[model samples]
Target: MKSPETFEHLVRAEFTPKSTFLNTATNALLPARTVTALQDAVRLRAEGRPLDPLYDDVEASRAAYARLAGVPVERVALGATVTLYTALIAASLRPGAEVLTVENDFASVVNPFHVRGDLKVRAVPLERLAESVGPDTDLVAVSAVQSADGRIADLPALREAAREHGARTYVDLSQAIGWLPVDADGFDYSVAIVYKWLLGPHGGAFLAVPEDFGDLVPVQAAWAAAEKPWDSAYGPVAELAHSARRFDTSPALFTYAGLRASLELVEEIGVDAVHAHDVALADRFRAGLAPLGHEPVPSPGSAIVSVPGLGRLQPELSRAGFALSDRAGHLRASFHLYNTPADVDRLLEALPG
Candidate 1:
């Protein structure tokens, strides 16, 4: 782990936020290196130079994310959105199979299963998620961290319950990956969008699956999913990749180019360090909220502090240079690696009495 002074230095050198940005749950601000990488990718296209380098960016990001998620590179699939990966998982289920999910989970994690129309989808509160898994449950899908209020799902309990019930687990890490320690190997399938806590641009997402790729159908498989993409470009793919690469979509090249740098930065700072830093700031904000007559949602050990009945203040907060979110009438503020004590104090000071 990096020392606090070193972590602070690295964070300051990488990010130059223009606001008291507390909304990493909504989207992350790109680091300076990522911005440079994006600019370079655009310039490379403008010059019509050989596009070969961008492909390396894609693979590097995949490997980096695989490492972060504690999965083998061969088990990770690259894609543009979490929904696409969720749809692939959904398609693999037999008709009438039940998927148990948390109520009001991010749509990408739950809607794909529901859209299948044939699957029996059940919604339960986050607290009851693990205990609700039973013999009838074929799969358990939920976000590792709740997006609306940052209530963390008990993944270990969920995994144990799923295993005991002869069920599979699918975890959405979109809001948890960068700052939270997740063991992707414990779940049957897990997906994350890089633009949020990963601090990358839009257009990059990842799906991690078990060694057998969770028997996903790869319904959208194209030449990109082939064992030899260039050789298989024209015809039906001679052979799909034997690994999870077979689930990959044609990547957004420029996005991955920037994401590579951003992910590398996260690797350098370490997720544990980021988790400690972010949660501390969030705790600071939470502690001060009550003194101001505001109560935050009860989310212990989370880096997101959400206050119910304060959604109307979002516009006022934004105008005052506090960047956060209004989610279903809750004022949601998420702290991240780039956030500081001063940032949290400023938001608290600006809040109404």
Candidate 2:
């Protein structure tokens, strides 16, 4: 485990954002090492060198992500987006199956099931989600941390509720993974895009499923999903992978090359350490908000703080070099390992009274 001082020092050395970047809930700034890896990948392609290393990077990321998510690599599938993975789950659902979701959650988690047209989709407030699960609910899908206001879902309660109702759970970890310690194995299915809190490049996502691959059909399967990819290249997959790899979407090679390095940094610092660091800064920001006459959205134990009615200040804050997001008229500020108390205080100082 890295000591707090060492972790802070590592973060300071690795990230050099020109702005006080506090929008990690929206996207993360790549660390210097990841940037170097991406540059090397591009150079390799430009120089017509062997692309073998890039493929190695993809496998390396799969292993690293599996470790981070606390699941066997066989249960993890590499993908380009959360929506594709969610769609695969949606496809597996029988007609008239019901999906319970959090109201106003990220669209990627909710839209796919609704688009199916035949499935019964229901949305409820986050606090009421666990209790809302019923015998008719086939799946309970929600983000671990809500994107708009950073409210954390009650995963344990949801898990218990789903189990009691004979329902499966699907969690989107895009806004939670790096800073939040999640056991992906707890869910029947989970998906995350690593670009946000995982600090990887866009186009890299992961899906974790049961060891038996659940009921998914891998409707988007390609050569890469075959048991023997190279041998099956010219024809339809001779045999789909027995594991969750059958659900994989062809990886974006360059994205994985950078992601390998980013995941390495995350491992070194550790998620628990990052969580402590992030939530402390967010609390500091939250405490300061009231003095500035701004009351933030109630989100205890979260690294993202959203102040309702402060959306108008976002453009001015951006111009002042404080990076954040304005979502549905709420100014959302997210903290991560790279953020410090000074960053929080400076943003507080910049807020209008």
lDDT of 1 by residue, 51-105 (tens): 7999999999999999999999999999999988888889999999999999999
- Residue 51: error of model 1 in Å? 0.8
CA deviation > 4 Å runs, candidate 1:
none
lDDT of 2 at 161: 98
lDDT, residue 58, model 1: 97
Tens digits of per-residue lDDT, candidate 2, 180-227, equal 999989889999999999999999999999988778888999988989
Candidate 2 whole-model C-alpha lDDT, 0 to 1: 0.93
| TM-scores, all models, native as reference | 0.99, 0.99
Minimal lDDT window, size 10, model 2: 229-238
